[model samples]
Target: MSRIWIERLAVVLAVVALAGCATSKEKLLTHDDRTMLDIWNQETGGPAGSGRASRELLDARQALRRPLTDTDVQTAPGVQTRYTRTAQNEIYRQFHRLPNPDLVMYVFPHLTGTDPVPVPGYSTVFPLYQRVQYALPGERVEDY
Candidate 1:
């Protein structure tokens, strides 16, 4: 009886370990394209081809779930009145329909004065998020 219990526990542990190892590869891939498409479609309907983009977005969103910090702004207050007029030029460069770039944060590598190291993990990429106004479902961008 004790042997049977031990075998079951061992099987469960092995399954958990395999699951963790299996997911490591997915973490390295870039799925942000889907996320961007989903947000764009949900806000503005473009074409029927965007369905795949929405699925990718859902996957990415699920993967990035984490506890929010105070500094993180889910929705920018006064996103239009404050940024729409002044950021018009900037918005034109970043997006076509909406000037707000808040859905996805752009991450770039930190520039160091030292020579670039070719080793595996010596530096990090920084996140740069552009704040954009979002509208609810079936709502127009101007409504925000």
Candidate 2:
């Protein structure tokens, strides 16, 4: 009976202690009476700081900033541009197109079907190789 009383007393004491430790929602969720601007001004020292840029500070920043001159930019001699927007460059980018020469064939006019309709002669081009071939970097792809 004494142990039971002690356990009950301990639980009651714990509940009371927890209640005292917990903050009330009203106090925790309460809005500040002072405006946000006023609080910021107090923290940043108003005229001295207050998050506004001064004319002298702006002038100093302008003095540091200057237009880039030709000498400021540097490029190595004999170094070429990596990529260019050209018909040949666009077709074969990153990998150079292998020397797959085109074979132009002329289609002689011929009669077709049971009706024997006349077809006009035309010229057609096809790569010697059925598919386009690409050469790896530093490989002999360009013609002499």
Each prediction's RMSD to truth? 22.7, 18.0
Top-lDDT candidate index: 2
Name the lDDT of candidate 2: 0.74
TM-scores for every predicted model? 0.20, 0.32
Q: In candidate 2, which residue ranges exceed 4 Å CA deviation?
A: 1-94, 141-144
Clashes found in each candidate (C-alpha, N, C closer than 3 A): 3, 0
Candidate 2 residue-wise lDDT at 94: 60
lDDT of 2 by residue, 74-139 (tens): 442222344445687677566767777888999999999999999999999988998888776557
What value does the lDDT take at residue 39 in candidate 2? 82
Displacement of the residue 63 alpha carbon in candidate 1, Å = 39
Q: What C-alpha lDDT do the candidate models reach, one value each? A: 0.58, 0.74
Worst 10 residues of 2 by lDDT: 75-84
